[model samples]
Target: MNQRRLFIASCVALIATAMSFAIRGDIMGQVQQELSLTDVQVGWILGAAFWGFGLSILFGGPLCDLLGMGTIMRLAAAGHIVGALLTIVSTNFTVFFLSTVVVGIANGLVEAAINPLIATIYAGNKTAKLTTLHAWFPGGIVIGGVLAFLMTQVGFGWKAKVLTLLVPSVIYFVMFMGQRFPATEREAAGVPFGDMFKELARPLFVLVWFCMILTAGTELGAGSWIPTIFNRVTQSATQAGILQVVWINMVMYLMRQFGHNVSHKIAPTGLIAVSALVAAVGLYLFSHATTVTAAFLWAGVFAVGIAFWWPTMLGITSERFPRSGALGLAVIGATGSFATALSGPVMGWISETHGTAQVLPIWSGLPLLLIVIFGAIYMVDKGKGGYKAEKIA
Candidate 1:
């Protein structure tokens, strides 16, 4: 199959996942109100999605290598279709939680397949291309937020908002139906499974992986709670929440679309360090913002901070540790997902007790800590003869 076709299909699949994320974020208030659930209860439901995502990719990456990307993607498409239907029909917290878990697993499977697929195909320009591929995540969020916002303007229920994801879901499923998939980078390089494990055991790999936990937490944890927090800060639920999400996602989309240029100028580790500082400050400002204007300004800063963390981390890992293959990418992704999973409840608990105003400031500490860690990585890389971008042959 053509690499462009594969990339397009992967983007379509990811758009479905991003739509689910937007719909879930937008409908938090509605679900809570209609179901008579508390902040903590809603947190559990949301947390289930991140946890399911973590678990699936933790295993799914290896499975993609073993069983092929096509199998994992097909399963992911099925999960999206079934999970969306279940969410539409959910009347209780348990059913709703289960539905998110199913969808989360589907999202994880998409990541498991596409991350490596892009790496394998665009072997020469891993960082730039990977960043370009992931731009669709925010792009999809923009589309989803606009659609959900317009639907709400017309007084369409939350259920209808969820059903919109099926459009992309079916399209990707058909696109992937009869396509042939190339072997993963590791497989093509003939790297042994034991070698992959050994690469992961290196000290540098472990350090970066640890930092990934904080990076993922900083980006995803805040994104998951933005709607609720913004609603509280702005004193508006529907329009304020959806509009804020759209604004943030649009900033992210633009940043990521142009991120390759930025990556060319700055090393990945340097970018991570800068991002951590910006994100920390943004979170603090966002938490303290008393006006909508202030909130949007700070949120733009936050978007800039988060824009490159996910894909850059993947690019760094795949470039530096080429032998680790799908397993390494899987572990990196799983770490972030799991951290987001844990932070979800923590954010909920904070919002439940301390109010949403306190959520961003508390979460800001992770990025501050990340600044230190990424700085250390920069120093270490310099000692190792400067930062050299790696490419898979």
Candidate 2:
């Protein structure tokens, strides 16, 4: 696929991720109020979609590799449209929550399918390329949050706000339908699934998976819980809406655009390690925030810290280890997706029963854990490889 087509398709895919999370921030509070939910119940609704996405991702990856990225993209676009309609039609918590899950599954399936697609399409420039591709996600979040602001003003309401996301779903489906899928390295080499999966499980592969779990867990856990945390800390329901996710994604969006460039000049490993500490400080500042402006700034700072972690790390796995193909994407994604799925409710329960202050440990501990683990991986890779592997393809 040409870069133009790839960029269009990636925008569609990233929009789904942005939309999934867009709901998590502002609209979630609206839905909860309309539906009359408890904190635990809200967590379930928020977490349910991720759970659907995480559980089904293992299947989505292989299917994409088997059926094709264009097919997966079209199917997932249809899902977002359906999910939007379901959310609009919902009359009860069951229906509304179920709709969120549908959206989550669609988003999860798309992530599983496309991350590998980009890795294959761009091939040699996986780290920089993936960072650029993932940048669309946070950028889309900024769009979604801003759209939500406008939608509410024109009497669009929450349901209308959700259904509006269908516009891109349609456009994405059309683009992908006319496009050609880039061939996976395994397919070009005619390797079978059994062989590809077996090779993906090697010791170094395990280290990559470890890094994915920690990074994903920390990032998603922090992003997902930020609003609830803000609401509790400052007791301002209004500001927390676009502020939390919007701020987080905005900083994330910007860094993702520049991360690879910065990494090239500095070093991706050193940048990641330092970024983790920045994130920890941001989270601490966020937890202690007394003013809304301070909170938003701190949130953005934290997002910047987490900004490059996912794309850079996933780029490492996919580019540095393309021999694993779609299965490799599946395994690494599984670890983090599952962690995010679990963290949602866990954070909710803590915030609900133990109070939001308890979230400090969860959010703070997550990045610290990632910094430690990825730092270890950095040491191990440096010691063993005795060389910085610059070649991506």
Candidate 3:
């Protein structure tokens, strides 16, 4: 498949996943309220999606490599459809949670398949392209959240709001159906899958794999909780606009779209270090913002710093350790995305007991730590043989 087509497919995939947030967060909140859920049950209602998304991804990436992207995508999409239906009919929190698990399975499959697809398609500049692809994630969130808000104002029922997401799901499924399937690196390089399997446990692969874990954990952990933190800080949903994820996401999106060129020209490590620093400062400023507009600017600044971390790390991993394949991404995702899964209740507890305002700078310190880790890796790898300093995978 062509890069352009791959980009379009990625955008659609993001839109689908982003819409799930609406169903699980805003729309599901309405559902839970109508059903009179306890606060703990409501937390389960929202957190189930991420839990499912993370746990399923542990298996999904390797499975995608084994079964092929087409098969994985189709199966996951089916799960999504089923989950969506289950959500519409669910009467209690347990049923709602189970439905979201199905949706989460679908999300995990999407990440596993789509991340590698973008990497394979833009093999020469994976970081920039990957960043561009991930940008759609937050971009989709903005669109979905805004749409949900409008639908609420206009009296659109919550069930219909969820089912509407089906339109894009079907369309993307069709897109995948018609397009020629892309090959994994194993396929492209004519390496046997057995050989790829043997390489997975090598020391270099392990190093890259661990970094992927920490990198993903750092990025997703903080990113996932900020919105809820926003809720706690702002004191109401209408005031919730004061701490929008969209600001963070949009900055991330733009940086990713352009980050590839900047990354390739400059040192990836330097770029990452600088971006992280810039982001830390942004978050620090965010802690101090007293009003919505100030929070927006700081959030955007924080987004700028975060924008390049994941794709660049992936680029670094794949380029430095080309043999690891989808399993590499899967491992890191398992650890980090799961960390995101745990962060919700943890943050909730901290907010409940410690006052929500205290969570900001503490979380902000995390990315600052990332700058150190990434910088050290950059120093170690710099000027190595045939490891051209400025090139990206």
Candidate 4:
């Protein structure tokens, strides 16, 4: 198999996955206005993507081992195409909500297939490669966010904004077609399904699973609201608010690209533990910013805190629990997205009842809690000979 071709195809697929998020987030206020939806309703609509993503990934994990990653990638592309079309034509709350769900499902499939696919092809370098592959996620967000900001400046409506999702979706679909895929690492190693299931019961896996909930929610939940929250907090231009989304993701893109350097110095859990403290500080300060300059400054801090989180979590699982395979990845990913799904509504209700400024400060608490959890884990690992990846036996 052409590892370069497959890896590039996987990155393109993730770009499409991330575009949906950036576009959806950038266009959210327009959607709310066009549909005459309440903040809570809009929250639910946005949350649907995570819900669809979580459920699809929950299924897509085992299916990767059963049906093949190629099939899952094909389905993801098709879903993105169909979901984009549905979103373009959607005029009401119900249609918009359902369309977002389709996009979410496509996003989930991308996670389900590609995490294991990268793990399989780069078996010896799973963590660094996975981190590099996931860098495209923020790179795609920068693409989508910049496009949305430009379209808004040119007086384009939300429908035109929605169309941008199709570009990457189609590109990835074409790229993935006719390319063969490798078996997942677990399968290649001949790890049984029973062994994969057994890994879930390990205490460390359980702790990581719970931590995924906080990490994913902290990163994704705040991301979905960045445009809207900054608009209210800075009382800035609509277009400028979208630019803040672009700015934060730009920071994330750069940080993730160089993350391997940081990883060489720190274990994943230790890195994430530090990320939690930094994220909490950044979020708290960002919530208090009243000027665009101040908002941009603090958003950078928040980006650095979350930049390594999602991929590093996947890397830790892949390295430390190699026997668990695709099913394990699905579980970690699904749990994170599901937690993110709930965060949308919770944040929305908070924004509705309290105010937009309160959202991030309250959201900061997730990472604060994670600081304690991951710090403890890191200390335990230090006591156990300074953290080594477990081998597949």
Candidate 5:
């Protein structure tokens, strides 16, 4: 029952996953130039990462239950090692895209295993613990961003930036070695696959799943493209791209560190409602940023808005529909990743045709939509005797 070790190991695994995102975002320009790719083509490459993530987790959830979390985690570790090697050796767009897809599946598998794993371990405080566990995501981003910035300052190549990911990757692999995994909450509760599917058919669960699409799109769509978009806006070729990423992640890191306290005061649905409104305002202002100061200010605001999104949505699902188990969490995660995958190309197309600044306004609609959807969800949940966390059986 050494939950602490398992928790630390999960955080390390997530750090590796998040670092991949940071490195990919940082080196996107280099990858495009070396491969002679257009903005649209770059979108395809970036989009593929999310697509692989979405598709893998779509199925990986049930597999996690059937195959065991330890098996999935080991698979993710192998994927990370192989994908990094492929990325290091890639010399063409096809090779690079394929490599990213491999890494993306690894990332998805990590989410597939860890989301439910953490929820099961910290059943009493699912929201708080999940938020705390996910803090490493932004934490990893900050570390990766700083490293990428320093590497660029020292005249290192993108390959070196990518190679830095191996440090955490190796740490997670070793931590996962010889570890024991707990059964999923659903499995422990003796909830069969049929009951899990039945939970998915519930009206509230369906609403939350739909909201997950917008919540993820609003957060990750902008997050995945921020480095390139901000660089274009600031027109700086130095550390501006990576620095902006660092700034946003710094804000996100702090917010997530304290998210558990915030969740205690406000219900998850209410939090999502408020977060969506703030994100909409942040996105609108970011689209209009004409100065570095303005961009940083808006980005900070946007970070606060998005910080709670992924974990909070998962928390809500875990609390409200405990029976759905890993499949429930995976479906929501898949929806978010799919939205991000769909948005990458559209955002790139906007940048290619209209400009990077224009990408924000078009995406602002997603949060606005969430404001309406989650607003209704909050009211519905409130009417049902307010928020209640399901007890793990």
Candidate 6:
């Protein structure tokens, strides 16, 4: 296998995933206004992406073993292309919702394939490499955010913004066309399928699984709302709101590039604990911002807080539950998505019933709770000779 080529391809696929998130969020207010939908209805449409991602990754995990990572990658590309087109042509709520789900599924498939792919290819440096690979997530967000802002400034419609996603989607799909993919780390180690499932029941895995829900919700739920929330909070131009999303992601991209050094000094669990505390404060401060300057300042804190949450969560799980293979990764990823999906509508309701400013404060509680859970986990790991990856044997 050409590891360099595959890794590059994986990064591009992730770029597609991240772009969808940024663009979709940037255009959400336009969609709501154009469709004449209520806040609750808009929330459901937004949540579709997460729930769809949750379901696909849930099934795609074991299927990766059965089908092959290459095949899963192909399907992910197709989903991105199809979903993007569907979204572009969507005229009603049902079509838009289903199209978003397709996009979500595509995003989920990218994780199902690439998470294990990175773990397999860079087995010696799983956490750091995965962190570096995921830096493109924010990288893609920056790309998409900037594009959306520019397009909006140029008087482009929301459909034009959505169409831009197809560029990376096609690029990744063509790149993966003839490339060879390695077996998952578990498969290469000759771990049995049943043994992989057995890892799911382990106490550590179970605890992390539960924590995944909160961490994901804390990171993505608030992120998904940033554009709309900031728009409402500052009563500023739409570009300002999108720029806030771009700014936070820019901080995230830079931080994740240096994530390996941090991983060496702090266990993944410890990192998560600190991230939770910072995120809570950042998010709370952001919820109260009355000016674009204040919004950007607080968003920088929120960005650093969430930068490591997703990739590190996956990294620790892959390390500690080597036997669980892709399933363990998928389970935790799916949990995060589903939790975010559930929270989306609730966030909308909170915004509608209370105010847009109220949403982040409510979500800030998620990470506060995470600080307690991950802090305890960090202490336990420290007692056990610090955090270490398990061997498959």
Which of the numbered candidates is closest to the native, going by highest TM-score? 5
Quick one: how many clashes does candidate 4 have?
0
Please provide, for model 2 over 1-393, each residue's C-alpha lDDT reduced to its tens digit, 9 standing for 90 to 100: 575786667767777668657755558777778878788787678768777787667778788768887777777888888988998898778888888888888887878777888777666666777788888888888888888887877876787787778887777777776677876666766667787677676887786677676677678877777776777677785756446787788888878776657656644666677788888888888888888888878887788888998777777677556667777777777778888777666777878787777686556766786677667766766787632543323
lDDT of 4 by residue, 1-393 (tens): 888989988899988998898788778888888789998898688668778999999899999999999999999999999999999998889898989889999999999999999998888787788888999999998988788878988999999988888888898899888898988888887888789899999999998999998998889888778878877767776547667777888998898887656777898889999988888999899888877788889889999999999988999999999999999999998998888778877888999998878888888899988889889988988998887887776
- Model 3 backbone overlap count: 0
- lDDT value for candidate 3? 0.71
Q: TM-score of the candidate numbered 2?
A: 0.89
Q: Which should have the higher lDDT, number 1 or number 4?
A: 4
lDDT of 3 by residue, 102-212 (tens): 988888888888877777777777766776777777777767777777887899988878887787678777777766667776567765657556666777566555555
Quality of model 4 by C-alpha lDDT: 0.88
Question: lDDT by residue for model 6 over 101-167, one digit each (tens)?
Answer: 8999999999888999999998878888889889999999899989998998889999999999999
Query: Using alpha carbons, what is the TM-score of model 4?
Result: 0.91
Model 5, 52-143: lDDT tens per residue?
A: 88888878899888999989999998899889989999998888999999999999999999999999988888888999889999999888
Candidate 5 structure lDDT: 0.87
The deviation in Å at residue 265 for candidate 2 is 3.4
Question: lDDT for each of the candidates?
Answer: 0.87, 0.75, 0.71, 0.88, 0.87, 0.88
Model 2 regions more than 4 Å off: 29-44, 349-355, 384-393
Candidates' RMSD to native: 2.5, 2.8, 3.0, 2.4, 2.3, 2.4
* Per-residue lDDT value at 251 in model 5: 87
Instruction: Name the weakest run of 10 consecutive residues (lDDT summed) in model 1.
Output: 236-245
- Candidate 6 residue 67 C-alpha distance from true site, Å: 0.5
- Residue 218 displacement (Å), model 2: 1.9
Give the runs in model 3 whose Cα sits over 4 Å from its true position.
Answer: 1-3, 190-219, 231-237, 241-243, 352-354, 385-393
Off by over 4 Å in 5: 32-43, 233-241, 348-357, 391-393
Clashing residue pair totals per candidate (backbone < 3 A) = 0, 0, 0, 0, 0, 0
